[model samples]
Target: MGSRICVFLRRAGWTMWLAVLMLGPAQFANAASPDPSLVAKINAATFEVVIPRADNDPLSYEKPLPLDLLPYQERTDKYFSVGTAFAIGHNHYVTAGHVLLAAVGDLTGAPALRDANGHVYAIDKVEKFSLQQDFVMFSLKEQPQGNAALATDTKAALNSVVYAVGNALGTGVVIRDGLYTSDTPEDENGRWKWMRFSAAASPGNSGGPLLDQNGKVIGVVLMKSPNENLNYALPIGVVLGAPDNMAVMDKRITYQLDVMEDTQTSTFKAQFPLPVSYADFSAAYMKLLYAQGDEQLKKLLQQQGNDLFPHGAGSNHILHDTPELSLFPELIVRNRSGQWSYTGRELNRVPLSGNGYVASGYVGHNFLIHLRRPDDMKVATFYNDPKQMMDLILKTGYWTREVGPEKIKITSLGNPASSTTYTDNWLRHWKVFVWSLPYINGQMEVFALPVPDGLAIMMRMNSSMGTHDSLADMKALTDFFNVDYGGTLAQWKEFLADSSLLPEVLRDAHIGFDYGKHFSYDAGNISFDYPSTLQPIAPDNMLFMGVGYYQDHGKFALQPGVIQVRLNSTDPDRISAKRHIAPSPDLDDNFKEAWGKLLHKQHPYDGVPYNDGDEMDVASVIDPPASDAPAELYTAFYGTQGTHKPEAMKAKLKLLTQQFKLKTH
Candidate 1:
């Protein structure tokens, strides 16, 4: 979701990164290993950045992660090492910015440093940071004894012998020799340069010191050039010379919604007084980040108004959709004439306890979902619990821990570590839950919206990187997601009672229904009511509410896009009222033909009956008011297997449209 942070996406960049990290057996120019005294000095200064392991119930696996997969001491350690860092001015410690950000939203124990002796020290405050350069300078709560500060150097000659020093693969701090190959300008504005080197750095090597032949810190080892052996580091001078007491997010993040082909770029920068605690720093940074993300998202939708969904040539089919009410959560895919249309998936279902089945499918990379509730699960109970949801996911073989020869099954995700709610732009409410899979360094994020039958869930699984990435990404992706809510009168009563679960619009809206008698819905802007005379008013009949762009009093906003009342699933006797936005460029032939038919008073949009067709229906359009606004249409329709005459159709439509007015006040 934030490809802006993609630069930091090199968490564990596969074997190619490892290839560059392990720089092979040969030292560049046949240089000797550093002196034992210098090695001791470097080792003393280095420490691994780590997060303590969560106290998990022994995972339900046929065979556990072999204790032998790791060194005896490491496997027995109390904390999990992530990256590396080293001391400079007694208390001043420096590491890669991305390494420090792992703590930004991590609910795990605070980010700390662990030494070779297994002593851990907590970080006290951030002194300086540069996202573009990918570096951070901070200090410890209490400095470790016996570790001397690192001597710094600003430059290293090209082709000179050097060493990549850090806890490679989290094994422990080790020194690997290589060449200080060359220099390349930094990507943004050529403000600084990156020291390209061929050194044996690894996943745990990041944020550790890149040292010169004399054992002086020349740079902070960062990332590897994926296509070549020339890996990179930030010259130590940059970290040393950065302005005192400041933090800057000067990175370029490219954000694109799934619905839009175009991307928006934010040179996202937020500078503030530093010397701040990690908690405050993280909170402040995220607050600013989400603000930017929200603004950018809105701008993207408006800027592409002409080409975005409901406007472009590709979205033609959706405008005319009469697809059956679906319980399977579907994604909007850009069709040929389908600038956007719901994806009909080929899902694989796995049975769970209590007659529940997990229907799983891949929407795109790393994105997945399960549709509706199991026959035996309760709407309120299952919708309110996240563990039950993930436990079902685990049953499908989706959540597994692979260690040595074992693909260990995780029977339960336990309770969620964090749970909250996110409201989308369309005023749709979704419940958000995050589960930590500590063994895999992974997190699973779930966003569940209540549908008529049950919940339509969208989930994201991310691993190896910091656990917060999944949470941050899922929240952003919620905006681009699609869902429709409806249910039998009984389901609606239970669902609507939880005001905290309702979107703003719905929190104030009401639906009053009495089985075998009448059904009614009333929101501030729209209302509809009906009796058994108009249609079958039963508890099991489906009533659906959709969200979309509504033109109101000269301003466009999100409101219930449509209100549909179906007497039953099989009956052709149904009533619907919906709004249509006039296309921007008016390019698509479908829209052209649609507008032609509407203007000429043709079959579907005209108040007359076209009974010979499969879609036998009568409809009338209420044009937008003559006020400051774009062209819009509100149509009330009645479709049945009963009548063929215009008068009969109009009579039913009149009953349907009596309360379907756009009330401005």
Candidate 2:
């Protein structure tokens, strides 16, 4: 009973009502074919204009804004249904002007037409358009087979029976019967007449052909009116009679679409989060790496071809990347034809909404992603380090993870000569370091490559969430890129030196130790000093010596372990009194009974007993040992669990043992 006119934007899940009244008898001699035959022929020429969308955009669920003054809404998808357009001339399609304007926001790709045969063709250019009258004509890149006829006798009597044909609810072309109610002036001036009809025209039905009882096209459906049983269509006579309307178009129409430049490029599609094809990959890559008008990047893309992406996702839904975190933003290939091999199998996956096919192709175990925003360069730099970069990327919300350093074969490019001294050169020039840890989800390895223009590639091992360990496969990938960089160490260094985004300092702050920076642990009764930086934990029932910072991936720390120096006040547990204790004793015994093993083989200094055991030796000291009273010191060293290896633990234990001493206050 109440009515409000709404523009069609392809919203799904709404029922439409249609009304048609028998036209007042106005017999015309030129009425053509039977309704059924004409309807069949017209329907074949109709097609659905579809725009490719990401899985995340809710194209079909959008609703009209309740108010007019609200801020304009934007969608992330490339295209959704605009009011339907039909082929009117060879390779020419026409649609409501408003519909085309609303659908092609910041166009990333051209709108495509899917005909009754399900074949798609790209819209090339606007041939005609008029904002005042609401109509647009465009040419298609691909030739269409047929076109619909425009009525010669444009006038329709009141109450004429008519049929509406269009893509309703994006399902397909549907023909609905309704009544031609009356004629009304288009604007306040009444310069032209608009045909009013009761044929149900729902969202996605605008710009379709309106026909008479004998199936001759009469008008173009444009919009629903705010009155019951009233819909408006531009008269066919108005469209066909005005020659100037055919050339009317807005000259400033621009789109942001990513499409193939030519026919030579083939396409390859995989599951979601993966590129649809070679063309899709190239288009996305070129968009991020090049500025809006960079011709050099375009040339490189055309010349490089598949060489740019030598690796492909195979059968596996999961793609394992190189163990190092550098291949993410960009891959630097030494040879133009370099390719990658991965261990994964392709499998069929059901298509998601909007996109129907989950095509099978190369699925890798890792994701080498590259992302950039045009506004990122506006800031000095988005992040200071790889950890900061990762934090910024995952900033959709706040989250954290623990990490630690791991050693791997590091090389720049494919040069073996530069590989001879890879470790030092890599750490200095590339800022290449590996941080690994057991994340909240699973094991992960992070590799960061400092690229130009605030760009970086973060390669990680076993990065895919919810997937089991793929370290073995990741190692193979890492080895491939390690030797893939074609440039020498000097050339790489020069590039980093010249890049605006690379930090001035390249040394990693989390690895190695300066043994000259001594530290002391004073426990009132017993105290000593070690050569390296070791912090002190309060002496408990057993005195504990804390060394280096070890937290959340061991950032800003090196060779972390504890030096426990226990004061066994009882003589029976003292090492000086028990020289006959077994040379090789139990390691699990408390510090009181473990003194023999802690000091088993060294010479004494002055009167104090000392033994720098093979497993335990001297560390360092900033100051001489000091105490308030004579204290019997029994020491044991232990490394933290997990990646803490025994050989590394033994080295630290020897340093602590030799540095262990008891002083009289």
Candidate 3:
């Protein structure tokens, strides 16, 4: 059976508590009265949450209001009992996020909780929360008279007897007992652990404290699984041991609430804590667009169409067409057949008829995922640690520009979360970072996920600075992201190999490249493997075969690197078959011809030897098995000594000899 969360709130000064009981301590068989001292502290420390009474209430924890509204504003008394929460840290109380969500509809108001003594304290602000873990931490506007000590250890022995304390069905503060059975995985990422118990808990028991024999809070009751008697709680250590500090002024969010009548499922709207500003969008967009060592990204953009970027510069409309658009709250994709298809996945329960929404923005394009990196790259550098990765982005100027060192605001960092997904072959950890980019005038995010035995898969999402509701859209994109983790190493290598980046180097490493079919140079009676990266340069006025064959030229130019070659043929001995030629007669008077296939020691100046300059190899008939047919000349030019390696040139010359065929006249 599906799991049900237990958390409730009331809208008045009087409050009550209930928690979905997870593993609880065993009740004494003799059923004697509990220790008076412990009970007194429990009664003093625990409080009942007050919320509005609504039939089939949708559990939500945000009190969304206009920006002008102050925190904890006044509201009417449509109040009732939610689950229980107990004070822990200095003036702070902890409870399940879902419980507080019950009274958190579209209104802004301070929710009060009443202790056993009927004294009430207002919840001041949400300090921290974990959506994956289902917990929320907030402080009291005024400190309570008493509070409970929290447990520090995360481990609980199997079958340990624990007490499940909560406001049972709003009757009063009640403590039940159950055995801590075992731990279970609660999320797809397998990074979080939940406590399981046999406690007999019902609706009003959620968000209450699960205490050990010492009465120290160990876990917070969450919900129960419908399959059996097992209930679940989040470990108290996890709630306290979260990775980030509670430093932001406000940590609450507005959510569109949905609750199923059967109580089988529910969905709460989620949004980014801060909207993406335009500067943030520009910075992130430029970084991905100009990412170092990302040759495939360029090709992928090219495949879509060159018109997307006119004259090598991105158009303003590009902001809407880029991959970052996937992070939008509303993403509509156009299929290959020219028909638009809705690819968005909702985080809510299965949609019932007309209640769902389709995202808006740039509406007619496909989101192609670039999920792998080069094999030679270190995967650890991507996201082994979240902060380090952020530092890298900052260093790359992906977030903010570096002008003055004193302008750095380290304390500005906030909104950190870890997401993960696991399959039999892979365990993926996505360290998520959300921040405002003043330089780009927008809010941006980075998802650094490492691949096993490969490079890191980094994805970026950006949005306008004022638009904060895009979590649902991001979830849909992440669902699409999971598909690539299952991609094979061969695919990644092939993707790199297919690009114009060091393809030959990858091939030498046994990562093969397919250059398609060889272009026939029928005019020169020669054909050989040509790199796919070479582009045909026009010969508007260039001379080849007395200018007659210029239109049928067999020459091409390499991009990103300057190098050129032309395929032409002459009589068998046009240049020289000799291995070496002494310094030219114009430069050195007395020199002898050395015999070999390549002619060596030639200079461009013809009469001068400048900066180790020399004329390279001249193709000729094979010396060992001299051929009788016509031999084509393979002449090449190199601007620098190191621009092209001599051994590589030799290989190309040798390949031409092997594959070159002489067509009979």
lDDT of each: 0.68, 0.39, 0.40
Q: Pick the candidate with the highest lDDT.
A: 1
For model 3, how does the per-residue alpha-carbon lDDT over 203-272 read when each residue is reduced to its tens digit? Answer: 7667888877667778988888887878888898888886443311212222221110011112222322
Residue pairs clashing, model 1? 4-253, 21-200, 21-201, 314-337, 314-338, 314-339, 315-339, 335-338, 452-486
Question: lDDT at 273 for candidate 3?
Answer: 30
Ranking by TM-score: 1, 3, 2
Question: lDDT-based ranking, best first?
Answer: 1, 3, 2
Q: What stretches of model 2 exceed 4 Å from their correct place?
A: 1-34, 54-80, 89-92, 103-106, 146-152, 187-189, 226-229, 245-665
Candidate 1 lDDT, 183-224, residue by residue in tens: 888776888888888886666567878888898999988887
User: How big is the positional error of residue 126 in model 2, measured in Å on the Cα after superposition?
Assistant: 2.7
lDDT of 1 at 532: 73
Stretches of candidate 3 exceeding 4 Å from the true structure: 6-34, 52-78, 147-153, 244-665
Candidate 2 per-residue lDDT over residues 596-655, each given as its tens digit = 333332322212322334222232221234543212223333323234344564465455
Q: Is candidate 2 or candidate 3 better by lDDT?
A: 3
